[model samples]
Target: MSTLFGLLRKKMLAPSLASVGFAERGFPVTPSAATVKLEAVPQAVVCGFEWAIEGASLWELERRLELVEPEQRGFAYEGATMGYTILDAMPGGGRNRTRELLEGPGKPHIFLTYIGIGFAMARLPRPLWKNILPELSGVPYHPTMSWLAVDGYGFDRAYFDTRRWVDEQLEPEPYPWAGHPGYFSRAFDQGVGRALWFIHGGDPRAVAEAAGRFPERRRPDLWSGIGLAATFAGGCDRAGLAELRQASGPHHDELALGVVFAVKARTFSSFVPRHTMTAAGILAGLTVEAARALADRTEVAPDFDAPEPPYEVWRDRIRADFSAGDQRRAG
Candidate 1:
């Protein structure tokens, strides 16, 4: 049962179902059978957020989250973790709820959980950003994958304020997240790229055109985001995936990098959906097994002392491998 305060928090902070609808955001998503499934993704996140803010116990939360379908269960965990991050940041609410979720049943879903923390970051004041990520010593990908939070932040901004971030192509001021201030905008653009997949209702042509609207410099990161979303979220068919790849053109390697990451995340969760496999084969030119092997071989150790974050290093390694293969083919 929720306390009065918890209920109040839910009422104040949780977004309504209608708020995430395509029409509500004025996105040009044409009505179709695919649209309903695509929209449900965000609504699942909203449900998870409400449950967590309502002070549900971990066991109760796990039960509720498990009820979500396998494909979207991770996203619900994303919302719940976001809610917990918000509660932890509030005055007199330092229950370490985010830590509990991430370190416990939320472990497998750590990738999405970090993104959820970013969603909370979107709602919280800048000062509280520091408190959003909790220390998870010995956890496999704690700080390194934490950059996904920024990606999540970018997704939130673009999804909510499309005119400024997406339409106007406005760039966010840099912050020293993960101690790489310069890379912040790039990570954020990747999130915006993910949003384009949804904003365009998984239409390959629309997503490509939207990315084209941005300056040439930002398209690579945006294409990377699109690749991640296309593989992981899977809104389109095999032909559509090929179309997206063709549209990527010069940024094809970056798109493949995103596909590799998405496959790695899914493999980590121990559930590689058929669509994800199909996407990997088409977008990255790798089978699910091959993608997982590539991600494993290219994995970088978490080293904050290094010039670049291990996350980017890991990404670069993947991109380089793809480029090498392409060069060999050209020869």
Candidate 2:
């Protein structure tokens, strides 16, 4: 038995004899290699049940078991969640600001929840709330001007499409499973986006319904565009998309579209920053932004009524700015 289990067993079998029993035996309460293996047994398929191996290697299975062990002992536990968490931490604004904002209250107050700011809002639990007042109020008042700061431009639309694929069609399999990317995708579609619409401006219930609507055909394209954006930019905003064009330069309208798509899919508060310059950095960047923007606008079905004409109009102005940038780049 493992040290913990041995101690537990002693407690269960003879509550008062635990200390004395170990002392008399002169045995340290440490878990032996055998005990570790014994404790590592897969509980879900153990005891009297038939143990059959499917496609998983014993090593992989063991690694998975180690993850849930609570001592930071499993690759599965770290690999899956850590990757998603890292991805989640990338988006509009700086990763630092995005993180501070998502983890706290933020400005534009789009993704962050500030009681008195850009839009109406409410307070959050102490543990959940992330205060951005200090960051926003800092010297030069240099609030993150571009969404590209978070490096969300690096994300590809396929990331989300893969999630959509597994979700809509997946045969049941034994062993534990996770949809980390799916969760990130949904967080944008359901959590962050919904939070932005209702918490920032619309009715919560209606916003919830609206956010749930997504096009089947566009899922793949949309995911691909987002993945591309994560590659170059941090976050997506009307202004940031325009900057992406400037920063990317020449024949790169697709990048512009990709960035736009990522923004529409989810607001970018938790974006990471990307600094590498690809060979066709300028063209690729511009192309991504344009593609993403087009994807976002086109994917939205025509029948929905406009709730915030002023906001939508403002957004259109931003889109037009990008159009001008595209024309300039083309010229």
Candidate 3:
């Protein structure tokens, strides 16, 4: 964010008049084996990031992300597979292709939450609207919901946050994932509940290009409100270390270490997605060990031979391991 914008954001986030909480909670953790059964499909709104390239369409962008067939990119793990989904309604065949990848015989989709086009036009500085309007004449967008404050990367946290918050507000009881009586409290208190996955090895410009700009107003504030509330509700932290270790054994150790390093390197919060750089022993795998392992080795060390899809190689492994039956209960 630009200095002017950052200051404005900070001013807005500061505790005062209507005090929307934006706590310093780290990233939330994906539940363990025992917790999976209890894990409800969160009433989430899938907010995807997109960029409107001059010549490129969302279709092409989605393909590059899927990295499917003959694309042969180094350090292949499932980053693209994790975040964002393409809407099935899109023209041409991209939607069908995405559906086949998601619902087809491939790995059971777990991480992805929604389908959206990154507002490719969002990257422009808001102040430049006057001069840029002529070039943006043909763009199609819902005026009321067109732009969302997604930070510099075009990632609008407000949509996701709003989804989660709305659920919490309207639900009669706490969410099913709330776990034990005080579980949510402790989780938020300690910062173990908020998390974001960081994908590796994508062109930066591609990402930026994909994350076009949107109107900036209450989006960031709204997202910050949800984020801060989650923090107070039991956000992510090192507290789960002992439990995570006891449940997963040596593998958990590696994951915990990696999580630690990730937090240290990226001090803002573990949820922040840095460029995909590998650090040893940090990429622990419960089910997708082969894929995670290969990813860690290649992304970190960068060695010979183009690797196969980690999900393809370890599909069975992830199915067997990370499944709901074997999940570990943090309590």
TM-score of every model versus the real structure: 0.98, 0.25, 0.23
Candidate 1 similarity to native, TM-score: 0.98
For all candidates in order, the CA lDDT equals 0.92, 0.28, 0.23
What's the true lDDT of residue 47 in model 3? 10
Query: Which of the two candidates, 1 or 2, achieves a greater lDDT against the reference?
Result: 1
Give per-candidate clash totals: 0, 70, 38
Question: 197 in model 2: Cα distance from truth in Å?
Answer: 25
Ranking by lDDT: 1, 2, 3
Task: Go through the candidates in order and give the C-alpha RMSD of each one to the true structure.
Answer: 1.0, 20.5, 18.6
TM-score quality measure for candidate 3: 0.23
> Cα deviation of 116 in candidate 2 (Å)?
22
The candidate that wins on TM-score is: 1
- Give stretches of model 1 more than 4 Å off: none
Error of 3 at 316 (Å): 17
Candidate 3 C-alpha lDDT tens digits along 242-310: 332343232333233233322222221122222212221222222223434433332321121224222
lDDT of 1 by residue, 85-143 (tens): 98889889885888989999899999899999999989998988866789996578878
- Model 2, 160-261: lDDT tens digits are 222432223221122111112222232122122212221112222232232234454323322223323333222233343344344333223333343443
